[model samples]
Target: MSKRSNWAVPYLIFLVIFVALPLILIVVYAFQGQDGGFTFKNVTNFFTDGDALNTFAVSIEVAIENTLICLLLGYPAAYILANKDLNKSAVTVILFILPMWINALMRTLATAELFNVLGFSLGKGTLLFGLVYDYLPFMIYPIYNVLLKMDTSYAEAAADLGATPVQVFGKVTLPLSMPGISSGILMVFMPTVSTFAISEFLTNNKIKLFGTIIQENINSSMWNYGAALSLIMLLIIGLTTLLLGGDKENAVEGGTV
Candidate 1:
């Protein structure tokens, strides 16, 4: 691996400076307290704080709901595109990914603005729309790619054997696309969990999310609290990645040449 070229040196240097160093610093700061020595006060305080717990709950709820919503809508679109006539699939793929080109913050704001135009006002409901709108592309693209890569023969054989189109889809296309669906969920899940910008700008401070808690703590120089919450958020996102194993098994099943 190291024989690749001169590129490895700069890439490794960048990783150390940008990723490894910062992670180490966060760990060091979180565990050290007022005496400039390591302590557990930071993590302990996080549990005792009502705001921290509340924000964590809200963030989890939002991220999970967002994942489900994306899966619900994205699955059908991805399924269609995957099993589509190749001649026209390109246009549909482009359309699904089109919204991603727009800035996420801008798209989220536009959603809130849309609600205002309809006299609906903005709040949690508007936030839900923003979450779905911002992350749907993430869900669709992975699933689409997976579906596109599937063996067309499987679905064809099912149909030839008297299976209805829906049955073929249920047993073949959808199941195979699970890999991409798993990836998309993880792709969308982590950011949605840690994203402070959307919650801050959209909900107008009416709702408290875990990301906002981190932001609030940092802004107030509550470094310890921020660190604790940051660690918890990271752990949660890591747990979500474990669910992606279902995709790997599917990939292995059909990957044989």
Candidate 2:
């Protein structure tokens, strides 16, 4: 064994203290009563409360909607960037990443302002628009990276053999980029599901997401229930990551080893 391996002793201790212990505390506190006795009232409240479930469902829907929108928009942009000519690549990347430098809240307010200028308002779409815009780069970059590595000779060869531009792109480019597309979609979806900041400020708090529920529970004096809700939210993302992680594994295996 090496001395570096011994470092894991401290790392493992830290993990047990921080991650493992807190999870145990959440589980313990989740079952703890007002008088410090063990109880299931918190979990019971979760299942019994229609508002909580409804809010959670809304949050899930927000995540899904934003993810679909990002995929719809990001794919073409990413494709363009990936297949960009030498002169335009740098400019295209800079433009794609321009929004990232601005604060999310600032961008959200800007979106609201722009919408008002057009005689439209963000209102219910506030959170949706914020998330899609904020995470757009995340969706684009991964797919762009995949595209950058693509062998265009395959596309050129296909076109040379009497394939139309649309046919070659639809048949090859899109399918080949599924790995990147899936990666970007999962990246955008995960954070959007748990996002609290944009939703709270932009949606005018009209929308309730998983993160918001956790915030309400904690900030509005629902500690145990908040913790439970947080745990549930964490579980949702964790399970999603696992499922998509399997897809990533398959993609990697298919693409490489």
Candidate 3:
């Protein structure tokens, strides 16, 4: 192999050991029974079990809610931060970045404590709040990076053509920023769907997401079942990635046109 290709050897090895091996193990365990024979029981149980199915539904609902909230809040924050006309000082950007510097668990615990001090009841509302607070940065930064790197000449030309500010934004800025929006959606949605800690800590274990179910199964020594659930989650995430990828491609094509 050439010298340039040789540089990827370590990364390939890392993927094989860390990523590929774990996935292979999950697939193996998912298909095997307690007696070590191949069986479809685990997968079937996931669909047939009412509690698991309900938990999965709840997880999807929470993820969708959190993703929407992040998009609505993050987009405006990103737009403001990206727009030099709106935000003059570079120092203001530090306010958002600073929160991310601290550990996520620490942040979650701090948020939970704050809620208690404020006399707020911990439940779905607090869970949603924690989700948004933790993942909003993920949504904002992707859009901010895209908007920062976006071509300004399109907006300038639209203005030159007597387009209103609203028209310029709708016809130009929004289309160009779709790639970032897609990226942000994927980042926020994927984690929220599989997240257990935020739900557990924020709601005091009152609310159980899909991840919590998986964790309980594993903790109770239900390896095959847990792996099946994990595999199912992986498949859903994969399908979402493919769908978003197609949408992103279409958006890029349409924007260019």
Candidate that scores best on lDDT: 3
The worst-scoring run of ten residues by lDDT in candidate 1 lies at 248-257
Put down candidate 2 lDDT per residue, 87-137, tens digits, no spaces: 365886889978878887788778766776786654566667778889998
Kindly indicate the candidate among 2 and 3 with the higher lDDT.
3
- CA lDDT for candidate 2: 0.79
Question: Could you tell me the lDDT of residue 10 within candidate 1?
Answer: 96
Clashes of 2: 0
Full-model lDDT, candidate 3 = 0.90
lDDT values, one for every candidate: 0.79, 0.79, 0.90
What are the per-residue Cα lDDT tens digits for candidate 3 across 1-257? 79999999999999999999999999999999999999999999999999899999999999999999999999999899999999998787778767778888899999999999999999999999999999998888878878877889989999999999999999999988888888888888998999999999999988899999999999999999999999999999999888887677533432231
Error of 3 at 51 (Å): 0.7
In candidate 1, which residue pairs clash? none
TM-score, prediction 1: 0.89
Across 1-257, the per-residue lDDT of candidate 1 in tens digits comes to 56777778999999999999988878887887977888988888888988788888888899999999998998777777776564364787788889988899887777767776788866788787888889988888877777777788988899999989999978877776777777788777888988877876677778767888888888999887688778878778777767566556653433322
Candidate closer to the true structure by lDDT (higher is better), 1 or 3: 3
* Candidate 3: worst-modelled 10 consecutive residues by lDDT: 248-257
In model 3, the number of clashes is: 0
